[model samples]
Target: MDFEAMAEYLPLYKDAALLTLGIGWAGIAGAVVIGLAVALIVHFRIPVARQICRAYVELFRNTPLLIQLFFFYFGLPRFGFSISPEFCGAFGLALHGGAYMAESFRSGFESVDRIQRETSLALGLTPMQAVRYVILPQAVTLAFPSLVANVIFLLKETSVFSAISLMDLMFVTKDLMGLYYRTTECLVMLVLFYLVILVPVSLAGSAIERRLRYGSFGN
Candidate 1:
């Protein structure tokens, strides 16, 4: 283990970690948007949109993310739709995460009683107003745990972005190991870095889940 080399590379790792977080968050944000949109479409049974959403979910969920990344990063260029590796990485993560998120959200939406929608309609609310005011809030609360789990899983999966030259934490660690030939130190540091980020996220998710489940919100 090259302690000196590891020390020198610490700053690089820090930057890479930050970059990874940014990419992961971007992906999560996109996923939320995609998930909600698809869930709503599926819920309303929108004619063409529901089928498109189902096809999208199946396509992403069934395929390996690596292949998706490869298609985005490599295959699209053949058709003149060029994108940067970073964009490809983030976009792929979003697309993959969105598929699973859609399922979570759909389940959550379905868990809400259909009577609620009927009640809202009886009270003279437009369908959009009813969904926005009554349906989505309950659905989101119901799906919170699954949503958090998906986000955590997506965060860890950012390591795979290194394959596309995105220079995330895992990529930086691999580079350091290759440079210094300090496999043990690099591996240990990689684990520690991931633990540093993921542990708090897991704890926080649990805490939130408990609060949501209990309907306390610490009040």
Candidate 2:
């Protein structure tokens, strides 16, 4: 509860917070891309590709991020594949988040009427053009809520990145507490920093959701 003492660690927390955001956003962006790709493949039912994408979704969605991080950071070296801890953290989050995102997007894709594809084709749109102009936009609008939730989920998952020695907020908090025995101060800062990071996302998601609900953007 010592304000002066807590102020001393502001720089440390700021840096850690930045790192957390960098990794979290990077991972989330990658997840969205990977998820869309997987969803598209499965939605189109591309024989071999669909099975592979389905297996990927099942595997990553069913596993824990910590174990995945451990495998990437610790286990891979056994096979001579050495990745930096930062890459491992970001990549693991992407792979894990992608699985859940795939389901969310796939559900959205399915919710759209199949006749839209046929109609677009009858209008002389190529298959790829139909997906781009008709299918994807509607699917994204339908899946917007789930996509926002998944982004938030992935951001929180960044907490586990510390397990791999990345200087994320949780790592800095734990390290400071261990060194100074100021557990209360460290924990308060941890909560505050996380709120700082997550609250905006929640607000932004709500704002976007409202816009999509009432705005002509979806039309």
Best by TM-score: 2
User: Scored by Cα lDDT, where does model 1 land?
Assistant: 0.90
Off by over 4 Å in 2: 216-219
* Per-residue lDDT of candidate 2, residues 1-219 (tens digit): 899889999999999999999989989989999999999999989999999999999999999999999999999999999999889988999999999999999999999999999999999999999999999999998999999999989999999989999999999999999999999999999999999999999988888887877894353
Model 1 lDDT per residue over 123-182, tens place: 999999999999998999899999999989999989898999988898988887788788
Every model's TM-score: 0.95, 0.97
TM-score of 2: 0.97
lDDT of 1 at 68: 97
Error of 2 at 17 (Å): 0.4
- Please estimate how well model 2 matches the true structure, expressed as its whole-model Cα lDDT: 0.94
- Give the CA lDDT, 0 to 100, for residue 84 in model 2: 94
What TM-score does model 1 achieve against the real structure? 0.95
Residues forming the 10-long window of minimal summed lDDT in candidate 1: 210-219
